[model samples]
Target chain A: MTIRKTASDYSRSHEPIVWGLFSAGGVIVAFFIPALILLTSLLVQVGIADEAVLSFDRVQSFAQAWWGKLFILAVIALSLYHTVHRIHHGLHDVHIHIPDSLAIIIFYGGATVLSCLVFVWLLAIGW
Target chain B: MSTSEKTIYRKPYVQNQSASWWLKNKFYIWYMVREGTAIFVFLYALILMLGLLRLAQGEAAWNAWVASLSNPAYIVFHGIALIAAMYHVHTFFKMFPKVIVIRFGNWKMPESYLIAGQWVGFVVCTAVILGIGLFVGV
Candidate 1:
């Protein structure tokens, strides 16, 4: 006869993996934000036509371009995950009992949906 | 006790708390935010590389890539990303004063002032780039 492990046992086994993924994802997004800002600023200076700088026209062109949109999406998605994870942990630090699993699902899930929508909108504009 | 044992001996001890106790402390939330943002920066780098690749491929390929990004799903995704990125930046700038610790002679600079300076710098840089773009016209 075999003994079955309870939910606690499963959680104990999986907790580290979940935390690790959350941490890695958080770190990736955190680092991407500043870098993207810098890169975009530089790109605007060097790559785009002079008139496009700071204007919606430039933003439109960049947003519409495949490479540009992807770059923007990656930055947003990763950062969103990172921000949510950090906020979750931050709340936990303050003795808030916000369930870790639920927080992860909501924050990361929300980020995914938002990123997808933005990418679609940019594409639709025919940029 | 031998001569070598003459010196006072202290009892060995082990920490009772978990390894993450320091991070779990409420006061350290800001530090965590800073660290979290650092991770996002790395992800952005990869995105940049992809963009460069698309740029190198020439107009048709690049346009095709751009067209694909128009899907509604992607637009929503980017919108969330933008918010996340803004949060990261705001937090990073807020923490800048603490992390850098700049002292002017005997007096230390205020963190608020440092944060304000950073925001100003960001605005100036953005303005400069925009100005250049307007002058050149793509």
Candidate 2:
């Protein structure tokens, strides 16, 4: 079933909030992801970083730090929502149209669920 | 024939783009790649989230998780993810200028300038983050 939209309702769509999250997530991906890749993957393999860099002691310390927790929270939650928003539009652009309500619920719901989990886990880290 | 007397009936070519249009050309393929990178990025975020969860569980679990990172398969996965992330960064910067409008005195900022500004901001932000992390003993 289609809910009719007046001009104002159409104009005041909640999409911008998703778009804002998407854009913020894009910034996190751009600025931080390479460093993450280096730290977690390439550096240790290539021997530029010590194996201890990712050792539980150091990483846990980092995660327990206030800034680390905040940063990780932002990166995880924002990227999830960003990717979901992209997936939502990309699916539409590629002509995989389900009902709008269903599409929104699935895409946004998945992000929201995982984001809440991320927050809970971040806090559970005992900072 | 006077111009007003001519009645031309032209057939309208009503062609809707196919869903697989991105597969047809390099341009579309690249656009798809740019869009597709988001999933890999989301995966990376999930990986980090898992790491956080493991950290919360205590050293044994966290260390085991860390140890798994050295696996050849995990390494290769991360490498692909790294490429996807770089593509995301490049494309995100390219899109920045389109969304942002800036003026310098009477002149509008060029797209190149806008792109460069994003890079500069990223660099500065990274430095600040690293500096804080180090100084704060993290």
Give a tens-digit lDDT track for model 1, residues A31-90.
444334533433333444332344445555666678767756665655555555565566
lDDT, residue B88, model 1: 63
**Model 2 CA RMSD to the hidden true structure, in angstroms:** 5.5
Candidate 1 docks at the CAPRI level of: incorrect
lDDT of each: 0.54, 0.80
Q: Name model 2 segments beyond 4 Å from true.
A: A1-11, B1-13, B124-138
Q: Which ten residues in a row have the lowest lDDT in candidate 1 chain B?
A: B38-47
Give per-residue CA lDDT, model 1, range B7-84, as digits (tens).
567778976755466577676665665545434443443444344345444555445545444455544444444554
Q: What is the lDDT of residue B138 in candidate 2?
A: 34
Q: What is candidate 1's CA lDDT for residue A16?
A: 66
- Our tally of clashes for model 2 stands at 0
